[model samples]
Target chain A: MKPIIKIQNLSKRYRLGGNGGARYATLRESLSGMMRAPLAILGRKGRASRPELWALKDINLEIMPGEVIGIIGSNGAGKSTLLKVISRVTEPTEGRVELYGRIGSLLEVGTGFHPELTGRENVYLNGAILGMKKEEIERKFNDIVRFAEVERFLDTPIKRYSSGMYVRLAFAVAAHLEPDVLLVDEVLSVGDMAFQKKCLQKISQMRSHSNAILIVSHNMIAVRAICEKVILLSQGQLAAAGRADEIVPLYEKLMLENVKTETVADEREEGMGIIRVKSVRLVNRAGTEARAFDTGESMKVVVEYEARQRAVSVVAYAAIRRPDGFICMGTSTRLEGVVLPPLEGPGVVELEISELLVIPGYYIMDVTFYDENFEFRTYFLGRKQISFQINSSLPSLDDKYGVFYQKHKWNIDDVNVNSPAHR
Target chain B: MGLTSNENVSALEPAVTKQTATITEASPIRHTSYQVPDNPLVVIAPTKSWVALNLGDLLTYRELLYFLIWRDVKVRYKQTALGAAWAIIQPLFTMLIFTLFFGRLAGISSEGIPYPIFAYAGLLPWTFFSNAISNGSSSLIGDSRLITKVYFPRMVIPIAAVGAGLVDFVIAFIILVGLMAYYGIGLSLNILMLPVLVLLLTLLATGVAMWMSALNLKYRDVRYALPFLIQLWMFASPIIYPASLVPERWKWALALNPLTGIIEGFRASLLGYRNFDWKTLTISAVITLIILIYSAYTFRRMEKGFADIV
Candidate 1:
């Protein structure tokens, strides 16, 4: 059988300091640069120049029909660019792609939906924008409306509908687009859980139709659940491509490899250099390194650091941060009026908590060493030195509610006999 | 290491060797030999030279084009209280302003025709052209979400914008017909060329719009500069005054503005009072063709970066 899609030698280059570049220079800068061109050439060694950065380089792949490939990468790794090129949203700077069948891309839902247009009108409009023929939309109109569960308000303008309702209707119309090849981005991240599950179920059903699917998402669990194969990208280059079970773990290992104690600190790893944080490790109550923890369990963090010189009135502190990078809480020995004496060499500080309060998800560790007086000179901070995962104790409690898990007691008291008499 | 299995490595190695591997070695593999020899390949490369559009692909996506046009038309007057009446009201009011300022105040000549009917006839194609240019130039940026997500002929976007303007042109054309009736004018055989004139006007508008829209991706100044450009363009065309106002020597120069002949042609066709200037029409047609071809080429060249920058 013929392959559904093939990519060959794809590459994209972007010029820095120009329009749409990282610096986002305006017309004024360009005009001034033009004026300085002659002088800049005379002083060529010191002149600032727009450099080229390749977003994607030399990508080659073949996807057969019925195959689902998940593209996983860090930010700026060109995962989105790869999908954009495949969908022909952006032309490849140097490569070619051949597609064997009708292709549809759902990069976003409600792309062209107008607030004043009725839901019924928007369904057809959004459907057509997603490459659905008018006849196909007409035939599937009832099913789309049913799936979105907006039948009661189908004729009403969508502006009055809640945001959740808007996304539901948008996803429903997009779901009805039956193309031979589907390219989906992180559109599933929207809507409620039940609606998200419905969309995922619909996507799995779409796989049985012998169509090819390429998905790009930051949600690793969703990718692992749906994709058979995974393509891992690192710095605009293909790092690995294989089965999801094999590649996801390898990718995670590669991502965490920088956490080893042997590496030197560099830029992007924050520190004041008066004292350097050697490592940050999570431990269970039993004092053993814990790869993962369960909610409501006691935990500890060890901050190992080395002082460059003998320093009096020093303190050690650590902050726990959610996966979204906001600090959840901060604790310090100095803040609690417990400061260490003069320190000359390597040392370790252990901060303990009675129970971990974060719900199921990943959390980062940031350790800092500073003077007792909180002076700016001796301040040292390690931002996101390490990360740990938390598992939910009960399957019923999910991460969708919020990040922190609160502890509380629940009870029911019966006042049965007095109720009717009092009334 | 487990995920990077030998089989996976071997599966990925074939592409590298296929170019150099001998036929005998490849034929022995049953799986490789069983499938049809080769799938059609599409190689993407940067534009090295001028390129023409693929009409067959455009034809296949005709339904999408129709849908886009309908969407533009529907969304234009969606929440307005006056709805599509705004279309007629626009040109009507503009003609009134011109009749007041240029006709009564400035004492501009309208050949033998009445000022309102003359201006309205001129305004018909002018309104269509300006609307087409404005909407078409902004279409790509307006639908940046779609452009960055879906694959379709990029030309369909600007084409649909122009197509949507035809609805307004038709709506406003009705009022122009009424004006002609009130002015006691009759349609001549030359009116048969009205469709041809409209087609030329659309081509000119679409061509310029394609160029402007494509450039707008890089320099957003096009968005701000376009309205002022159109205002100046209207003055250059024969809208408020007749083309005969210009001396015979410079009429050729004025014909260089494509809309001059198109608007003059609209008057001659609908009002039946003026003779068609064949030389001016020929010059306009040639210039329109050149602009259309050149803009399509430039548009195609710039389309590659649209998704990246947009």
Candidate 2:
């Protein structure tokens, strides 16, 4: 089968600096620039050789029909640029994209929605902008309104609606668009949880209709859930493409490594001259550094610090956080009433747990150091300082769902069928 | 030392984990090949030619153009106390001012027709032309969000702005009819040429608008310069005065301004005040066509840069 979308040697270059870098330039500035560099102006080039940034470089990809591909990347990784290029929102500096069948792009929800217009009017207007025919919009009008759940406010201008309502209406109009090839860019992270679920369901439904959907999103959970395949991009280049489960973990590990190196460099450069944190590590029972631990395994968090001068009554804190940024556990020496020795050149603080009860998933550890009065006179004021993973080896423990793994047993005492208190 | 005391740690754990699974369970991959109908395939690449007016795309996106025009017309009068009445009020009050200043005070000739109705007829087309150009000049900037987010024939935006002005033109045309009736002016065979004149006026406005709107996306100087340009252009046209008022040598120059013939054509057609000046009308048609073709090419050349700069 022919691919729904095929891109060849795609590249987009943006010139940096000078008036060219600005969105628009005034006539006076342009005139002066031309006068200052007549030869360059005649040549239709910048006065100096302008630096260029390639938003996308030499990208070749083919997406088959009925495939849902997730694009994952850090910020500035050409994800949105790729979508824009594919949708023809912006022309590429080089190369070409061939697309089969009708294409619809939802780079942003409510691309042409007017606040002054009523919700119903905006639906028609936005639908038209998304390439839906007038008859198409009219046919799906009720479905769009019902999905938005703004039936009562259909006649009211969207400016009067709450922000949630506005997003819902916008997304609803976008969701109703039926195209053989659909390109979406982070529009799923809109509205409340239930509405987001509805949108995900809508997207999965689109996938089942034999449409090719390309989604650029930072939400790992959403990408993992709906996409069978994932593409990882880094620095405007295709880094990897594989199955969703495999590529997502690889992307996460790359992100964690990047964070670790950046934080270590930051610590050396900005060490406040009072107390500096040298390293933070997670160790298992084998007395070796580890990033993965099974449920109920022994784990220790060790923090090493260097003090410039004698300081008395220092306090230390450690907190474990889930990938979703929820802090599972937080503890401090001050809260526990522990006193520390003074005049430390170098010292180590360890938090040991006999049983690491965290459920199987990725987690982050944050450490803080301060004076006994809670004044942060120490270095390393950062979040997500270290990240680790958890896995469950026990089948019984894997079935239960929660943040922490708890050991419990169930006892079944059979009540005799023939002797229910002689009832 | 171990810091695992229960008093020291804050466990903000919820008692119940409802586990409302939002992620759909991954089904086995099905290699279902979609049988795409013979829909038109689109190939996107960097423009190779200097001029690429994909006018067919305008036809394909005609519904979008209509919706955009509807949106403009719908939103223009919103929140105004007078609502659509402002459409009639703008040209009506402008005609009053022009009558007071250019007609009575300046003693400008109206070629034998009554000054009020004469000026009203000229103002009708002139108002639509100027508003279309002014609105079209900034239409792309105003829809910058749409430009950057969606793909359509970029020309549709300026065309829609020009199209939306027809609503006001039609509304103001009614007042022209009322003025003509009050002045005892009756329709003539020349009146049949009104649609042709209106078409020329629309073509001229759309051409200039497409050029200015595309330029405005890059320089923004068009925005600051447009209103002033419109005022000068109104004077250049035969709106408040007759084309014959100009010296003979300058009359040719006046004819060079396309509005000269189009405005005069409107008056001659509606009021039957004078024989149709076929030479000036022909000049107007040719110039309108030239501007339309030239501006379409320029707009096409600049189209690719719109989403990036906008």
Candidate 3:
């Protein structure tokens, strides 16, 4: 079968260190550079010379109809650049892309929304911006308002609407565009949790209509839930491409390997140069050391340390930091009102979690050993010494909405007796 | 990870292909195939030589163009207390100042018609031309978000900016009609050519705007320099003063500036103060067309870098 989209040897190069003083070379630079061009050329004859950075290189992929592909990579791995090139937002420096259908790109939410315009006006304006005709927008007007749930504030200027309302209306307009090929960036992270689920469902529904969807995101669970095929990029080249199950784990393992190396070499071990952490490992209930854990599973974190000084008060503290570099949770033995005994030459401490209800994503662990006196002075601070992954086995789990899942139950007590099914 | 769900797609793949194959055989137009000979296949290459305008693409996006213009016009008056009254208020006050300073104090000649109507007629087109150019010149830079994120004819941005100015021109033109009614200066068959003059002015303004907007994307100095350029251009045109004040031998030189011919043509056709100069209007139209084509070519050439530079 012929592919719906074909990309041939695409590449994009950018000038380095150019956007700071100006986006491009100033007139003065051109003049001076012109005068020194010949000398510079002669000086560079014996050396390899170029200041260009290739954001994408020799990438070739064919996408079929009714397929959803996830593009996963570390930061600056050209994932977004590949999307921009395919969306025609920017031109590739080399090669070509042949497309067979109408393309609708959602590089950002509320991309063309005007703050001064009413929400009703923005819906039409945004619809037009996405290549919807006037008649089409009019036909979808009621559906859009209903989906956004902003009927009461339709006439109000979008500037007055809350941020949540603004994103809801924006996504509603975009979702109804129904292009044959949908290119979505990391825009689903907006809105509330239930709304994010609605958007994911909307994207999947678009796929059932024989449309092709390409999504780029760092949220592994989002890609795992929606994508059939996955492409992994590393350093501006395709590292691997296959099914998501095959690629996501490889990508996760690759990321964990990089973090492990950094953890070993980095200067995160901070203290008075004594009683430093030797190793920290996470062991599941099955007694196997693992870097990843499933939600609702018990796990143990073991910290092994070497202490040169004896008879000194030391309390082990651990903190979990989200990807945005904020500490989400932290705990210490002293904080829990348990006094630790004096440290010896070598020791081990274990912090066990009954059930890891945390959401799916990568997280950094900061383990430190502080004095028992609750003073601000620290005996040792191990910063980013270990990292772990908490994945959800539940199919309904959404990682974009929040970092943790709180356990709760719902009760419905009152019901009118109409049929046995009501009970 | 939906590891097992992908098996369902692989299971459904062959049936889907067979379905598409039969549909393509039945109706080629309705089927999805880039291989169809008559269906144009768009190949987006990294680098290609600059081509002339893709008028078909621009035509298809005419609705978007309309919406953009509507958005500009709406946003211009959205938060303002006076709303669109500012459109009428602006030219009226400018005309009043010119009537006082240039007509009374400076004793400018209006030929046979009243000075107020003469000045009003010239200012009508002058205001439109200036506003269109100033707004159009910054249209691309001002809409950096849309330009960088979306794919459309870059010319549409400046064109819409010029189109939005037409709303204000129509509003101010009503005052020109009122002045003509009060003065009892009847219009003749020459008044029918008013649209042609408006078109010529639009082409001229669009030409300058295209050039300025493209330059603004690169240097950004164009943003600061544009207002001063428009001020200088306004004085050079014969809005407050008559073109007759220039010596006839140098009238050819005055005609070199397209606005001179356009403003003089408006005064003659709208107010009948002087005989229409077809030769001057013809020369202005030719110059306008030439500038339009040149600037359009330059704009298309520079558009590829707009997203990168902007």
DockQ of 1: 0.20
The order of the candidates by lDDT, greatest first, is 2, 3, 1
| Model 3, span A1-423: residue lDDT tens | 566688999998876544464675445555776787888888974223536778999999998766678999999999988887877778889988988777888878887899899999999889998899999999979878887889999999988776778888888888777777788888777654577888886666556444678998887878878886899998899999988878987887777667655543232566664577888888898999987887667888888887777646667788776543345677889779877787777878889877776776677777887655423223243332567777775656654557677664445577433321112
DockQ of model 2 vs. true complex: 0.29
- What is the interface RMSD, in angstroms, for predicted model 3? 7.0
Please give the lDDT score at residue A331 for candidate 2.
81
| Chain A only, candidate 1, TM-score | 0.62
RMSD of each: 15.0, 13.5, 13.3
Give the alpha carbon lDDT tens digit for every residue of A117-162 in model 1: 8899889878877777789899989878887889999989888786
Worst 10 residues of 1 chain B by lDDT: B28-37
Go through the candidates in order and give each one's DockQ: 0.20, 0.29, 0.20
- Candidate 2 chain B lowest-lDDT run of ten: B12-21
Q: Give stretches of model 1 more than 4 Å off.
A: A18-48, A256-354, A357-423, B1-38, B41-45
**How close is every model to the real structure, measured as TM-score?**
0.74, 0.77, 0.76
Error of 1 at A23 (Å): 7.8
State the lDDT of candidate 1 residue by residue for B40-77, as single tens digits. 53445566666657767688778888878888898899
Q: Give the per-residue lDDT of model 2 (tens digit) for A1-423.
A: 667788899999876646555757787877887686867777867644767789899999988776789999888999999999888888999998988867888899878889899999999999999999999999989878887889999999987776678888888888778788888999887654577887886776555443688999988888988887899998899999988989987887776566556533232223345766678888998999988888778889888878777766667777777543356787878778877777468888889977777777667777766555323223233222577777776455432466676654444586433311112
